[model samples]
Target chain A: MSALIDLFSVAAIGAGLFFFFAGTVGLLRFPDSLTRLHALSKADNLGLGLVVLGLIPRAENPLAALKLLVVWALVLLSGASTAQLIGRALRRGRK
Target chain B: MSVLPALDVGLALLVVGVAAWTIAARNLFASVVGYVAYGLLLALVWVRLYAPDVALTEAAVGGGVTGVLLVTAGKRLDALASAEVGVPPGRALKILAGALAALVAGALAWVVLTLPSPAPSLAPAAAEAAAGPGAGLGNPITAVLISYRSFDTMLEKVVLILAVLGVWSVGADAAWGAAPAPLRKVRPDGAMILLAQFLAPVGLLIGVHIFWVGADAPGGAFQGGALLAAMGMVAMMARLAEPPRIDSRKLRLALVAGPAVFLIVGVAGLALADNLFAYPQNFAKPLILFIEAFMVLSIAVALPMLVCGPPNGSPK
Candidate 1:
């Protein structure tokens, strides 16, 4: 059971890596500013979230895991709000 | 070799990719968002590298507050520029800069992987020293911040107060009633308003909890205060509370309260204890806790007010 859990954790991490790569590709290939923002928003949030989840099981204690969770939650909150603010500003500029 | 190191390498790569996109993006607004994303990813990297304290600080100050500031500034600047005008770096210049950045990244990675571990981190020693009579905390960081390094923390608070004063002196006040062009009046009964009301109190509770737990865990005054500030911002957005007038005397008092209390406490310590800002060994926890609580409240208000920008009741 422990081996299986470890394998699953490794796979989750790999999945995170995949999302991060997708974000990079999207960032480079997207034609417009807003679309690239969309790519970054989805990719980085999911990528980091998955990675943190993968690490939680390996944490030494519950407090350590809680700390990891806090970091992830803050990131998500800040990332989304910032994206909205920037996107709104861009739209306003065009008008 | 463990697979953990391989995962660390991958995380480092992600950090690099995010940094590249942040600086290279054609749109300045997109670039600011990219920077926020970069900071968040970098915090994760810190976690993977076993620096949880640094990670927490990076997540709050770097990813959270800095992101808010940049986006607010970007919005103010957007009105001055045309989006159609792209500011792409010259091709040769880009290549040269890319090579230089890559070289620096490689050097850093090499150092990180090759550096030998130092014997005995100062944490254990600090923890041992803090375990003296009347010390109530088990967490080394908290002990250091409040007891051993109390002076540093006091000075840090002073810096924060000075920052608030500087911001105020520069006429940093949010433009009242300058909602975005698409701003619609959020009904007081709307889901968003209701949600803000529910979350604001809960956020306040969590902030207090985190502040209290700092003595034993990964939370601290800065993180707690920033969270409270975030709640305050939500309240402002939902119009649950009206923005204070730029010249309001009450606003000025709250802004200065944190530092004023900190100074008073420090002076009392000098008279009662052996040194300035020194809490009687038995009173360290309560003193630190009291100061942090007030600091959190002040910071929560001061930061959002700073972002709102200038007192003339205009958005810019």
Candidate 2:
């Protein structure tokens, strides 16, 4: 059971890391503000979500697992909102 | 053999790189962003050193509140347009400043290196007291902050109140009793309003929980209160609430409540216990928590007020 859990955790975390790397590359290489933000918000959120999912199974207790989820949720909420706000500001500045 | 050392080295390098960027960044706003990132990275270093309490403090005040304060100041300066970019220092001045910085760093390094083989520490004494007379709090940091150093804690709250007063006293006489300028001049759109609505309550809950768990955990009143203040700022930014009038009775009351309650308790302690700040043996935990609750309230109000600065808006 532990071996199976570890395998799943490692696989999920690897996938998450790939997305994070992709997000960083996009953020650095994207030509425009909106596109960079698009790469960042979408890719990073999925990356963090996957990482959280991977870690939850290894949490010491149910509360710890729940706390991990809460962290991800809060990050997602803030990320999405800030991305929208930033995009709006960018549009306004161009105008 | 272990990757931990490499990770630590990398973290230290990252912190230094960010700090250097913060110093060297040409744009004021970019420097502030670098500063914020530097603070967060320093907080991570603190965590690696097994100092979660300090880490929380660094992350909240150093990164979060200070970032907001600086960004707000920068925005105001930009809006005023009177803030001319100052001329850069000449080569001689730059070299002199570098020499001075190097001298300070070298002196610090010398002092640290010349310390006795077994450096003095109060950890043993603190541990003894914390496990015995210091109210048996599970978290040694809390015990030190509240039980062992109650006077310092109370005075710290007083200092915050004093800071708020100091900020207020700078206002023009006409702006007295008025609110500070709104944090956001632009009307917040739907997304911001929704973020504030969804996040504030959850943040408040987490803040309280952080404070509540402080007796046995890494969280504390300052960290929790900082989070609460951040939430309040978010609400203000989203136009869900306005910064209160400086002279509002309720606002004044909240500002002073923490230190006032703490002082009153300390005075009462002289009668209840032998020392000025001592709690009775049986009631220490409850009293500490009670005092901390008020401290949290005061901190939450004081920080946001500090960021808002002296009142600038006309009286409502």
Candidate 3:
């Protein structure tokens, strides 16, 4: 059971890494500001979320797991709001 | 010998790549976003390195708080005419700098991995020693932070209060405008508003739970405080609670309450206990709990105020 959990954890972490790489590549390759934001918003939030999920089982106790959850939730909220704010500003600039 | 090291190496490379793109990006907005992404990844690196407390702080303040600040600044800057910045640094310079950074990072990583394990971490020892007499809290971090290291925590609150004062002093003239129109109208009946309302309360409850549980668990004052602040943010955005006016005495009180309470408690400790800020061993848990609860309220108000800039009046 522990081995399976560990395997699952590793897979989740790998997925996070993939998203991070994709986000970075998009940022470098994309031409427009909006597209780059798209890359960042999509990848960074999910990447961090997955990483946290992977670490959940490894947490020393329930409190640690709760902490991880708080971290994840904060990332999700801040990521989306900030991205939205940036997108609005970009549109305003275009006008 | 282990797979963890390999995973760490891979993540480090990815982080390096993202940071390079972020710093070198042509568009300022893209660069800001990249910086945020880099901070998030850096937090993950911290977690891999076995510093969960630092990871939490980095993720919240570094990734979340700083990201919002940068994005707001970028929005404000967007109105100015776009002037093309100078050419990117030469490839040779980039390579030289990159090589040097890599060398330093490599050396540091080597030192960290090679360091001999101490017989016992100060944290566990402090927890055990304090459990019998000083601050009888089972959680080492909390005991260390609010008791043994209470002076540092007191000063940190002062720094936060000073920061709020500085913001008010400088940007006192700016009006409290609604978050861009789209966000303002967030449809009274929108599903998102309903969801936020539902989630906000639950999040607050959990935050309190974490705060209460911190005495023996992984949660603590910072996480609890951040979660509480997040609830306040959700309320402010959903228009469930109006943004307080700059001149409102209530707003001022909330801003100052954490530091004032901390100082009072610290001084009281001096009178009641042998040392300054030496929380009474019997009531240490409750004392820390009260301090954390108030600190959470203060942080929630102060952080948003910082992001909102100077409050002119209630947002229309």
Largest TM-score belongs to which candidate?
2
Clashing residue pairs for model 2:
none
What are the interface RMSDs of all the models?
6.0, 0.3, 5.2
Candidate 2 lDDT for residue A85: 91
Lowest-sum lDDT 10-residue window in model 1 chain B = B176-185
The docking category that best describes candidate 2 is high
| Candidate 1 vs 3: which has more DockQ | 3
lDDT of 3 by residue, A1-95 (tens): 99999999999989998999999999999999999999998787988889988999999999889989887886677677667776877886999
What TM-score goes with each of the models? 0.67, 0.96, 0.67
| Local distance difference test scores for all models | 0.73, 0.90, 0.74
Candidate numbers, best DockQ first, in rank order: 2, 3, 1
Task: Please give the clash total of every predicted structure, in order.
Answer: 3, 0, 0
Name model 2 segments beyond 4 Å from true: B91-96
Top candidate when judged by DockQ against the true structure: 2
Error of 2 at B3 (Å): 1.3
Writing each residue's lDDT as its tens digit, candidate 2 over A1-95 gives 99999999999998999899999999999999999999999676999999998998999999999999999999999999999999998999999
Q: Candidate 2: lDDT of B164? A: 90
